[model samples]
Target: MATDHQQCPVAVIGAGVMGTAIATTVLGSGLPVVLLDVGQAELDRAERTIEIQLRHARMMDALPSGRAPGRLVTTTSSSALAGARAVVEAVVEHEATKVGVLTDVAGIVDADTPLISNTSGIPIDTLADPLPRPQQLIGTHFMNPAYLIDLVEVIRGRRTDEATVTAVTELLAALNRRAVVVRDSPGFVTSRLLHPMLNDAARLVDEDVATAEDVDRLMVGCLGHRTGPLRTADLIGLDNLVDSLAALYERTGEQRYRPCEQLLAKVHDGHLGQKSGRGFYDYREALS
Candidate 1:
């Protein structure tokens, strides 16, 4: 028999780029989703974003056919999360903000409901610290463009039990995503290794070593990489990259993790990559 909570919608907290993408992925799997944010404007934008992404996915033959997409409910009320089957937190990468959101989510959802954090690099155990049911809290680091990414990094906290891990991994499988389970650590596997290289790529552009185009072309042409590091940074958003790099540097005290000056400058200028219409490359025409 399915429990009442099991039949309820998955709750996604935050309505930013990653949040909307996650909601779209869940909806693509035919699961209703409640997308919550503190502001109505953000939620409205998220709704539009999800609609467009869903259409694109369908056109690309990326979504499952013959099944109507799941219903999406946008809300500003935290109480709406009470009976969520699972809660995914996709707020800003700052530790304090995530802790505050997870702490509140922990109280609203059922005791058995899994608390999934879509944190890029922050440690899962650190985010679980504020929650009463720490064992239910885990990290599901969905890459940028979550709906299209086929692999997800699953981080298990120190107290995360076997059942929690199983539940999350199974959920990923249902969404047509492979889960690569990794031990809890700041930056985990992907971010820790990827960010340093991205930062160096930015350094090359900043020092006039090569034009962004030349650098990317060399990487793609010579290394056979699908996308160059700088272009990947643009897709990931310079602001997000800076935040993740800062978090890693603060947590590990590693010099390599320090965000390069070029990234900081780009973020300060509000040139946030593809979403902002400009970054290393001009996306205004593409976005328009």
Candidate 2:
């Protein structure tokens, strides 16, 4: 049953940027959150990153001033999620790795506890296959810098139950995000529309048609885009963008959705955008 004030002990697995953002956002929602990552080091880094994000969010008025979310608990043990009512997996974009995480967390959490994926483009149908309770599988696509972005796409898998979708949508609304219910399709709505633009920007830079600066200037100035596609890709992370595009193109056979060579090369060189302090434009340590 969907409740207005469901103060669940939410378990967020993964300590990367998105994972920490999920944990921090849930904590800010006044629900107890258990953050489980790969190991002690990752958890420690996650802790630091979240603290930085919260402070930044405060500066941006995204989070309340003079008050911080007090409902966060950190752990390296998967057992920490044993009694959790919901587990949100905010891990890497590999199917095999994510499946393993879903399987292990499902084993630890309560049977009725909903397992959600914070995936950008992974299809929930494939994820559901590895789980015993297929009806419980759902996707919550949080835009990068989760605490800031107000959009959370609630994607329903083929076998997903209506109740679970309603529950998660309500949960996201409680977190103060605008929840958009998207059907289970390759790239869903946001990525399907946004990725091609980003790829185009990458191609422009790759072909030396325009400098990165000019491209961004042209996009924001002439086109009136909030943030240019190339810059947005940097913020989203090239590797993640690549994975999403690859998944979309592979599943739907759309050539335009194919990831660009420059983008793939940047990912291989470890130029993972702002998070890594470099991408198209160099980030000089987390936006001052």
Candidate 3:
């Protein structure tokens, strides 16, 4: 039997860009999903956002070999999460915030219902500690714009069971995501490798090595990066990046993990990214 045929509905909390993308991708694979948010307003906004993205995806499908997917639903109640087999928490990155949400949501589901985090830098070992079934807790870090990215790092915490990891990988395969199993580390391999590199790029800008645009262009054109760190930061949202930086710094105690001064200033100034419409570049008018 097909995995989708036997698969239970997926519950995605947070309904942010990444959450909705994951939900959308899963729904495309014929799996139903319930996107839950803490507030009704947020739930409504996310539902609309998913609809817009669905339309764009359908347009892409209409191109020569089209295959647009059907839509999914959203909810604001924990009660709606009753029958979900897997819950992906894409909530705020604060440790306390995550633990609180997961702890609460974990109580309302079966012990077999896997609890996954959409977190990127936070350690799975730390986040899984307070959940109901720690063995069933894992990290499923989807790249930004999850609908567009192919990589989904499936991280196994100290208490996470092999079976839990296996089930998540199987589900990702169904959604057409490339899932990579990595050990539960402070920052994990990807974040450890990436933050240092992005930090170096930020240092270049802080030290006046090149303008932000020039540094970004050089990296993409010369270094063969699809998207340079500076621009990537803009898209990732500086606040989110800063949070990751703090987590990595505290975990590794590495000076390189310390976010650049200029970067910190931008974040403090509220020039977060495309969401705020300004960061390393000016976009006050365009965004307004």
Candidate 4:
């Protein structure tokens, strides 16, 4: 028999790509969702993004036919988080901002309801430190395009209990995503491996080794990578890349993780990748 939790909505904060994808994946798995954001316009845009992705999934026969489309609710009010079975925070990467959002969400959801962080590289322990239920908070770093990606890095914080980790792992399995359990670290695993390559790629561009397009092509043709490091950084947002690099460098004091001059210049110019219509490539005409 299905318990009442079968009907309880999962609450997702931050309405960005990661949050919306998280909500979309949960809905595809047949769970209701309450997605919260601070701005009405942002929530409206998130709804449109979700609808487009869901329609595309259905067209491709990727979405389960039995899944309900109208199961998601969007709100600007934090009060909507009440009675949520689990909460995932996917806000922009900033320590102070994330800490504040997590603390706020922790107060609304039930003590036992799992709280998850979708941060790419922020230390899970730092975010969990201030929460009332530190043991209940765990890191579930879902990759970009959350609905399509199956790999989720599950980071166990110093204070995170065994039960929380197991519960989150089971939840990932239910969503059809695989979990790679790892101990809390500066960049966990993926970011540490990926970001340095991206930084080196940017340095190549800075030193005029090759055009961004050519560099991306070499990785695709020679390296057999589906997407090159430069393009991936653009998709991830250059501003976000800077933040991630700074966090990694600060935590480990590693010079390789330092944001390169090219990246810094692009961010300074407000060319924040696809979102800003320009970064390594110009999407101005296409995005408009």
Candidate 5:
């Protein structure tokens, strides 16, 4: 039998931006979370990030009042995942890295506990291939600032069972989020459609067609997009965006998904957007 969601903590295997955001979302929903990372520094940073985000949410009245936030446990040990009601893998985008984490997590959590992957583009089936129970593996592509995003793209792997999908959708519902189930595909729906636009946006900048600010201005002001492609790339982290683009390109053999030279150069310089204070645009001042 599946464990009670209310009584057991959710295991978040990563302390990066998405992991931290997901943990914050789960905690805000009043469910305890075990946040695991390989680095103590990263775990410490994640804890701080969660605290600040939660505090800000409370201030903006984004989180419900009069309910204490759920407890958060940060650790570097996979053993801490024992008895988790569910496991969310938000590790790095590399196939090997994700597969390794999921394989380890499978051994710790209950056999029936849902395993959700927050991969931006990787096919859920590919990640599930090495797992003991592929049916329990599904993808929950939580958008950036997961606490604020109301919709999540749910990907059903070839072997993913209906029960796993139902349980995951129900969990998301409890967080006040809607899940749009989509068939498994390289990059799935969001990244397949999104990365091409981001690539073209970067190419425009590379070719001197427009400045990053003006490009974003055109998209936001005239195109009715809330955020422009370049800005979105920055928020996603240029490094991570490049990795996703490369994966999409490799998986689909599509030229449109190729990472632009400018983006690659930016990452090489470590101007990793909001995280590094620079990318398509400088964010040091804003971040400071």
Candidate 6:
């Protein structure tokens, strides 16, 4: 099981924030990266995001003195990943979408290439069920701001092989991150506990027990958290939070995992947090 660097160029699918962050981190680690998405516009946006991150790193003296941004290649086709040693799928958190992307990636890469998913809560076995080689399909849930997050949740499906886990864990280590290997469970460790708290916060807002601001203030002040649970939900996006909650409910049939009505209402209104410019707080002006 060769690490990402040993394989040279790594293929990172999806050009969203997480995808760009993973690609940038890989490139910063001195491995060539091929970033693939559905359209040229998406690729262009990913490129810009990557460049901005790179420049920021340089300003902070995080990148090697002579490292050029040219280490990254952007494309609209998965075929460009033919030479990649491994592929990481950071697409949307939908089961069908992730299965489709992983199926397509399996077709393009070598049989032994490690296929990783950055799903926050979807069960690994469910995502791997459709792939030809489920043993290679593992979860590498990197927190947001992938480049800066030192902790990565490595999830192993029932069929996931030790070699695949070792390869991914070693690759993360190479990039100066810690890996906490966990079994394939809905929400794994972080999301299982975190989402319930976030949903409870939404419940408080729904019940008018406290305003979103007050609840957040309590978490930051009383709980000693850097960010309030509601603000964190805003950052995670209302739609995403709902999806995670739904996934947990579907898997566990637990009432607590059911998304609060207010969360659902906000998603329906399209106030999807930072990306959509509004959620618990308005970001329209700041987004512009």
Better of 1 and 5 by lDDT: 1
Model 2 residue 239 lDDT?
A: 88
TM-score of each: 0.97, 0.93, 0.90, 0.94, 0.97, 0.92
The weakest ten consecutive residues by lDDT in model 5 span 58-67
CA lDDT, every model vs. true structure: 0.91, 0.83, 0.79, 0.85, 0.89, 0.85
lDDT of 5 by residue, 1-288 (tens): 666665788899999888999999988978789999999999999988999889877776766556688999999888988888889999889999999989988987888899999999999999999999999999989988887777999999999999899989988887778899999999988998888898899999999999999999999999887889888988888889999999998998989998989899899999888888999888899778
Q: Give candidate 6 regions above 4 Å deviation.
A: 1-7, 56-70
Candidate 4 wrong stretches, greater than 4 Å: 1-4, 59-61
The CA-based lDDT of model 2 is what? 0.83
How do the residues 128-147 of candidate 1 rate in per-residue lDDT, one tens digit apiece?
88889999999998987888
TM-score of candidate 6 relative to the true fold: 0.92
Off by over 4 Å in 2: 1-5, 64-68, 285-288
Off by over 4 Å in 5: none
Best by lDDT: 1
Between candidates 1 and 3, the TM-score winner: 1
Candidate 1, lDDT over the whole model: 0.91
Candidate 4 displacement at residue 68 in angstroms: 3.0
TM-score of 5: 0.97
Q: Cα lDDT for residue 125, model 6?
A: 94
Error of 2 at 204 (Å): 0.4
Candidate 4, TM-score vs. the true structure?
0.94
Q: Candidate 6's residue-wise lDDT over 127-184, tens digit each? A: 9888888998999888766776678999999999988888888888766678999998
RMSD of each: 1.4, 2.5, 3.0, 2.2, 1.3, 2.4
